[model samples]
Target chain A: MDLLGINPVLLIASLMVSATPILLAAIGETVVEKSGVLNLGVEGMMIVGAVVGFITAVNTENPAIGFVTAAIAGALLSTIFATLVLYLKSNQVATGLGLTLVGLGISALLGKPYEGIKSPTLQSLDIPILSDIPIFGRMLFSHDAMVYVSILIVGLVWYTLKYTRVGLVLRAVGENHDAAHALGYKVIRIRFLAIMFGGACSGLGGAYISLVRVPQWTEGMTAGAGWIALAIVVFASWKPWRTLIGAYLFGGITVLQLNLQAAGVAIPVEYLSMSPFLITIAVLVIISARGNQGAPASLGRPFHASN
Target chain B: MIHFEKRLNPSRITTVVTPIIAVILTMIAGGIMFAALGKPPLEAIRIIFWDPLFDPNFASYSRPQLLVKAGPLILIAIGLSIGFKAGIWNIGAEGQYILGAVFGAAVALAAYPADSVLLFPAMVVAGAFGGWLWAMIPAILRTKFNTNEILVSLMLVYVAESILASVAQGLLKNPEGYGFPGSRNLQQYPSAFNAEVIANSGMHWGVISAFIAVIFAYVMMTRHIRGFEVRLMGEAPKAARFSGVSTTRLVVFCLGISGALAGLAGMFEVSGPSGQITIDFNSGYGFTAIIVAFLGRLHPIGILLAGLLMALTYIGGELAQLMLGLPGASIQLFQGMLLLFLLATDIFTNYRIRIGGSN
Candidate 1:
């Protein structure tokens, strides 16, 4: 099939659609980590959101509501996590793993009835001038609302963290929890809200997978996107804008390999699929090589009230 | 204002009872999940806990099968327990498992139709090396680059699965088997087969290795200075550092053991019950072993019993599907519920629950 002899452009366009899910999820997780709580159950929550979003989209025939509803479902599920880590002070890592197992199981069970059904499509949007650009028009500018929202989210998050008073308080709480508590701030409440917001963003990301990327329901279809998002958070050094760059970089690698397979490279197709993960690891190593200063000072450390 | 505080000196009785309470709560939550799924809670409960050991029809087949399933699980969990104990998370045992199978099977296939006693040992070594090498990817990154091992290891599983799919379809595809995508049956090859040493009891080399691993783990965790260091690292990283435990060394040790044991589990599985490397060879044994490691309260004896109990669910769940026309996925969900509720109810391990209202 010849589409104006620009196959790579088409491939890049498709990659953007695929990357949207991870982009949204990673951005949210970046904020969550910045706030000093490490939630490993992103994969599980995304799966649950996928099922809920698909069922809602199929039932109502409105993809927008379906996406919002999925985000709500994810936030509600994350409240369970927040209750444990924030209120009960459970280990975030262990609790997050448990959440993933439970979320995967629940989604599998719920997704059973809706198995083999198609989700409502999310069509591309066209702007007045940007969509009409010569070569790089539709590929970059025209996308589903979720993609643009994720971009906007990146900008907004960056701005907030860099300039806002609330960001100052949140970062303060993350960098030094006991001092923040002594300064008359609500550490638990701030974390709860941050976790919930992150959950919502992640939920929307899963909704994008069901409603756009795959456009069908399959168990474990979120694949390892949640884990990728987590790594990308670290890859970005816990910054929202860098998270976008890392996500799209991953997305580009992910898309390029598939294109290689389509182009019938001499290498095996299996290795093509594996390329994204290998590259992600390579990137992680490069970013992490900066050593002790890369990670957040408070990542994975539980804050007891007294401490 | 009323406040809740953990007692500095809790009784040993409370320690014993908390896990027991966790068990009871897990069962109750599990039963509720089964009920919601339109299955009888009693039947589901019976099938999960009791039917595997007592039911006449399934008991005979499942009794021997228990050791078969438990062997790999115990071996993998024993390795994982060490990492967890040392606060080094290696979540990609599934990837390690697949690499092991692929590496081991590559050898057996390379020597196609050649009968020799050394073939099996060579494959075992290759398989263990494969898993250990895969695990080292994360270990090296974590120690050298300060990368998160949890993400690095977990993501590698997908890559391993792709390798499995590609190899099973391409290089290892049986020539005489009419275009099927799987290796030759190693069980038929006497030199490579891991046959049961004790007939009718599923007591193979794998089971023996599992028992040996448990014994060694028990000794290492209790008697050795390394064990003390591991416990210290997990509970108090600063204290562990000050106490002369090298973080890098612990990372290597924890990840290396887990990878080697997981590799052994994979090697045994390929040579024994599985017989060949096929597409989707891993049935989440690596992931399920995580639950086993935790459910056993991270102890050697606890892991042994947890392995048996978890294995019972696999056998009984299969029986339930065969007899009751239920989907196999449901059983996975049910088992997952056990872990979810277990974690949810374990809030009492450190903190005492205080009533919201007081006089």
Candidate 2:
């Protein structure tokens, strides 16, 4: 009973940690979708990021370096996706699925030797006076660096999409790539960049799992977090702040399930394990029912420049 | 500088040759991967591509296994291709597959130890219906709520996995088998078993169903008005609409047929090779069927050949693991590479690449 006890403050704080990876990935995906590129390979990128980040941190002993390398790895993989979809004009849905297959296979192959290996733990930072603010401090000011970074990224992405020229260009590209091209904006270049950024964020999220959350290497460690991130992007209605809410809500569900399991709740373990996916999808259905009017008009549509 | 010039008519020669070219490229790349892992590239490629068919010692065993492996793949891919050609993506056939197995197995489990000729047939019907019902979740959602079917279907796979695990450990656990988390082996139950039809050839109800599906799909795509409507819808949705094709109905039909086929594959697999409801009965035939569907160029005959080739890889990959100690992940990477190269080279089918030319 004592071991399974759930403290409200601790539960809320842990929710932030659980949410960070999806938050980072969803925020990045929102940017990519805004640019009219729907990269369904977030799972692939995240797993690749997880394995590469784990190996890098294992060799360098620095989680920061691991995260950066993971981002680079994710971006590099996304380039393959970009080339296939953008240049070759392959089906976006099929290409994205292919990318995921490639990522899972390659990551499993790469992480084979690193199985059962452990890396240095990521330490949480404490704010000076804020750390003394009781429940609020522990809940808000006591997370690892990535937690703060994820929230900061949401803010940065929201500001960029809402108040900047580049943001307008991205939104314009997503709304109608042909019209954006007519306006003389480089549609392909903008989309390519956005896809790369999304890949990087997904990588960082994967790295957070391997280097911070579990701090160990395992094949397919990201599980379906990537898929959850995709659902969250839709649940957020393509909005950054809503993405934050969706991620936390999902993260909260995940953490709460584990706590329930520990508390020896009579619910079947399988049902609890499946709740996050079911809940996210249910929300997606409800949100889309109200109408997907916010979807970028050109979402999932390939772009071509006429001569 | 290079430019891709769109062709007014896709090259017939390229359509036939591109898949071959992509396959050769996969071989070369896969050979390099083997060499990197310190195995003889030639021997590895020979074992994967050639030995499965010709090796006297392994041929008899591998030959039957090929049919066993390809049966489900072909069955599922046939269903998937129908929807794919109609532009309705049922990305979660895997979920339908799992539910079908559960539903079919439940029927058999309920009649355990009974010697009735009707048990297996009942299981088959239950399996197909189970799959169709599972598929309806996405279909209804897409038509009614206008939600993205791809994401929804894929998400349901995870949920289905959970249900599979629950059933294996709970409702389906064998009562008389020392508390093991699996049902009574269908193989031991003659009434409920999907027994081999012809002695020692691995021919079963599943393989027969696959052959039927292939022929049905071929005729549907080539000789039916519905097939033309499907192709028109995929190539030009607005045109399809103008031609009086009901988009909603087409979506439902595509999803329903695919789901039923996927379910049939699951039922056959569970009753035949798998023999019981276990925690990990699904070996990802559903996901792998997607690759098979595309590799076949979404053509019925092409899928048949593709299914055999993929089945060969599975057998050969296992052989390589035993003989050369190559990790299993390498084979998965090889499969993914095939799809990547296929997509990359498909460009040549519809466009000519101009070198150093300004369009």
Candidate 3:
């Protein structure tokens, strides 16, 4: 029998699971920013996803449908945001914050009945040879489909951003929307699609939490994960590979603090819990100090297309 | 052929009518949502907006609460509107609010055994300073490193929450009480309490401060050179620089003001309604203030009216939770929808849409 001891490995695994939501949310936010629209409502969207996903899973007895429904709900919510920012030319920051407020309210109303009930757990999938491998296996490969898909998403997004014509067009639009508009491209359409895609990704990330991570609906369940993800997007400098690095770095610190808490270190649990935010501030400082992190030139500016 | 056109002015009637139209539309949409939830849409709408202010049983308690809840929101939003107008986003007001509570509570706790009038004022000043100091971190970082203030300030809220939880649980824990995770009740100490200045009327120092903030904000926006610069900066950054406005100084000023106001609100909550520095004392006022700032169209008078309305919803929401079994957070969402709808309809301010599409 295994002796009564602090399992660093298991603790780390749980941390990864916790960090997954942030990673997924931040990655989506990074993409949204890259396309030159700063949508700060990721937290709102994720929480919406959490409630929608939880309700769907509960009703259907299927987690995959829950994930899909969550993504759709998130995108639908984001569409409201898109209509305002894209068509109305409202301040992105203000409208995004408003979207968050709306999301939080809607979710709380939706989730009141679902509270305290455990969601059906998301099954972990094991890769054949990778599952047998040491600590690296569980940490890297042998996990839920969402984890691997997030990695694949990062790679795909990076490649598409760097290589494809669509990537060039997107980057070009972000670099100068006015210029892109003159070149006969629809600036509003591109930004709209990007915003929706970001919302979808954020929704799935929220699903991972409600359906798998905590496996329960809690008030403010995403608990500023959306905000952390928003910061991580800035930390990554609108780059996909950098997003991966930024996410895991955040993930690592987040997990380490929890492990320290469970390991019963001398440090207070409050300090450990607060470590992720502090680390984010520290990392952002370092990134800015080092130099420009390649933030898109047109980010957060409302593009009014009349000459 | 190219047509270059500018529509500069709109009738005063449209300006007032647009927000009402947006509100009506939001209600219709919200009704659909309620229906989807299997609730009577009209009843839900009536309960959300109307009954709180008019209903006999709830109105007595909720009427007084309106001023109390609105007080801090108005103070915080007025502070934030200035910064937002100056093109400096201070999203960390939540952190500032928490820090304010912590600092004020710390002062109250340190002077716990001392029953002196100086205790409350000292704590209020300390709380304002606490928020100012927290906000300054981002201002300095942004000025020095050219860092993103949005991320810096927003992230600090979590740090502030952690600190709040830590202090509430350990350092400030009431000794006489059996290990509860909060400080001594300021309300119990008459010298430190922030009770109504006028008995039975819901008038407190916080409400008084909110009125003062509105007057100050109005004067600043209308008659002051600094206010002109703030509006100019948001509309045209290049023009602001050309007009010899100091971006760095303005950043510090705007952020400092917002943080201080937010802190004061937190201090008031700790002293008055909340009465103690508990982990759950903050009810997302910082985030909600962003809503008030926008809903009020970033104007002081607008915020004053908007703050009152938001306060009503908060009181109404609590009532709904008790009576209709509606969740508390739906109020926040309803308030958010006010901004969303306002922003969406604000397009009419500049552009007229044709039936098929904009022409």
lDDT string, candidate 2, A124-204, tens digits: 999789978988999989889899899899999999999999999999999999999999999988989999999999999
Q: DockQ each candidate and list the results.
A: 0.58, 0.81, 0.69
Clashing pairs in 1: none
**Candidate 2 deviant stretches above 4 angstroms:** A1-4
Which 10-residue window in model 3 chain A sums to the lowest lDDT? A1-10
Q: Model 3 off-target regions past 4 Å?
A: A1-15, B1-15, B352-359
Question: Each candidate's iRMS in angstroms?
Answer: 2.4, 0.9, 1.9
TM-score of each: 0.95, 0.98, 0.94
Query: Which candidate, 1 or 3, would have the higher TM-score against the true structure?
Result: 1
Q: What is the per-candidate TM-score for chain B?
A: 0.94, 0.98, 0.94
Q: Positional deviation of A173 in candidate 3, in angstroms?
A: 0.9
Q: Report chain A TM-scores, every model.
A: 0.96, 0.98, 0.95
Least well predicted 10-residue stretch by lDDT in candidate 3 chain B = B1-10
lDDT, candidate 1, B1-359, per-residue tens: 43445645444564456556666776777678777777787787788778888989778888999999999999999999999988899989999998988898888888988788899889889888989999998999888888889888998999999989998999888777699889889898888888999898989888999999999999999999999998899888999999788999999999999998898899899989999989978999999999888877788988998898789888878877776655677667666666655566555666665666533
User: Order of all candidates by DockQ, from best down to worst?
Assistant: 2, 3, 1
Per-residue lDDT tens digits for candidate 2, residues B157-263, read 99999999999989998888798888889899889889889877888999999999999999989999989988999989999999899989998999999999999
**DockQ category of candidate 3:** medium
Model 1 chain B: worst 10 consecutive residues (lDDT sum): B1-10
Worst 10 residues of 2 chain A by lDDT: A1-10
